[model samples]
Target: MIVIDEIYISDEVVEEQFVCDLNKCKGGCCVDGDAGAPLTNEELNEVINGYEKIKHLITAEGRKIVETEGFYHYDQEFGWVTPTISNGMCAYGIVDEKGIVKCAFEQQYYAGELKWKKPISCHLYPIKISKSKNTEQQYVNYEPRDPMCNPGCVNGQKLKVPVYVFLKEAIIRKYGEDFYEVLSQIADQYYASKEAKK
Candidate 1:
């Protein structure tokens, strides 16, 4: 695992899968999401070519999602397209010259340029921020992650002081003390769980 701080979390699981194999896991994200990946303004510009292009592709609900979440996305409840398979392959994934399905973003990077920013929703994958159903404003604990794409992120490695230092300041600005405290506890728990993993 790529531990960012604190004592090392055993790297065995990740070394076997990720130390050198990360790029091979491309196309995993796009294999499913169809509505579109959440994107920031800059990333949107890169992908959709500014206002005119995006104006046509997004739905009305998409506008609301972007306004509140700073990301454009599809609700799973909205349902994915039928047949799941498109031309004997995943709908949104990109095919290589040799016809392998791969991540659309990974393909973007494969070309001459790499678009550095992803939608905030895409950036915070595996680690989700949610509002409780009973009270949309209230925070819910972070959800358990889907292991497929999240396998090597050092979830249980304690954010070392330096790492926490950077994170805490940003969290405080976004949420204040209560949020920060809860988040710190959450981080600890997440790392502890990660450390316990086989």
Candidate 2:
């Protein structure tokens, strides 16, 4: 593990390569999960405030679920999470013409309709953040969803893109630019030392 500013980062975060292959995965991460995407307290407010603007972008079924059950709910294990449809798909997920699920807020944000760009948890996918129960130290772990993420993993290896590099924007958004810069530097040194040893 690499410890930076008290955040414990797993080795796989720097060593593994990953870039989303949307065409193949078809956004299965949004649909196959047992619970909806986790949301921070601030993000929960954003969803509540922005729901009206993005409601039209959501599917009828999703809108109905949100209307009846509310935008989000507390999960026993995941804390606060977006509501899911009866099929277990995120209530904010919409199907595109290609049958790919997309975030309603993201679609509206890209179209200049909303300022918020969906939940950070969704943005930083394949990398999950958890706190150590005893110490409360945050851990950054690389955990790509299996089968759904196979194509992305294969694509990343072929392109030689490291997981950190692929998630540059997200890391910066979550931890700040300085954190990303330090991570990049550490990753470089780690790889260089590994190469020398080989």
Candidate 3:
């Protein structure tokens, strides 16, 4: 239950951690990342406003991409496709002073107490809030994974429960009650399991 978040080893981060050669692995997840999850009115407004503030900074090509790409999630003819920031290498990924495309918004947009300018789904990663088609109950699992992800942390550092609780609060609030109910149930099971162990 606790060790589920590392479900996917985004190709870019994977190469960063191992092999030391990330050239082949273009940081796709952070740039484009998830196919957009739902955004409540408040969240949606925040994104809209934020994009507006930065719109001037956006290149002509970037603006074109934005209009076409829509939100991190969007409607498609076949069905729906969530938006992702990385279009392979992302249009916004500018080279750093060190000469590498910055993979994290935090690294670039974070300017002291003003991280709001940098991230939207900051609370959303590591956990995926979704529902199984087979069952109606909503559930939060570690992000849907790929092969590169494994027990990357030998002693389990990155995906620990504390990190989940603290770092992911914004995402939790956005997810709201449907997800809250499911989490409460999982909590009950956790307590029960602990009691049994004792």
Q: For model 2, where is the 10-residue window of minimal lDDT?
A: 130-139
Task: Report the lDDT tens digits of candidate 3 across residue range 1-198.
Answer: 322232221222111121111232233233444333344444555555556545554446556666797744544431233243434444334445444444233342464322453333334444445444565554544542353223332213343333234323444455455544454455556657868999
TM-score of each: 0.36, 0.96, 0.48
For model 3, the superposed segments whose C-alpha errors exceed 4 Å read 1-28, 32-41, 56-60, 67-73, 76-86, 89-122, 131-137, 147-155, 158-163, 166-168, 175-198
TM-score leader? 2
Comparison by TM-score, 2 against 3, better one: 2
Ranking by lDDT: 2, 3, 1
- How do these models rank on TM-score, best leading? 2, 3, 1
lDDT of 2 by residue, 1-198 (tens): 989887999999999999999899999999988699999988988999889988998879999989999999999898899999888889999889998899999999999989999898889999999877888689999999889999999999999999999999889999999999999999999899999999
Residue-level lDDT of model 1, residues 112-136, one tens digit each, is: 2454332334433322334344543
Model 3 lowest lDDT segment of ten: 12-21
Q: What is the alpha-carbon RMSD of candidate 2 to the true structure? A: 1.1
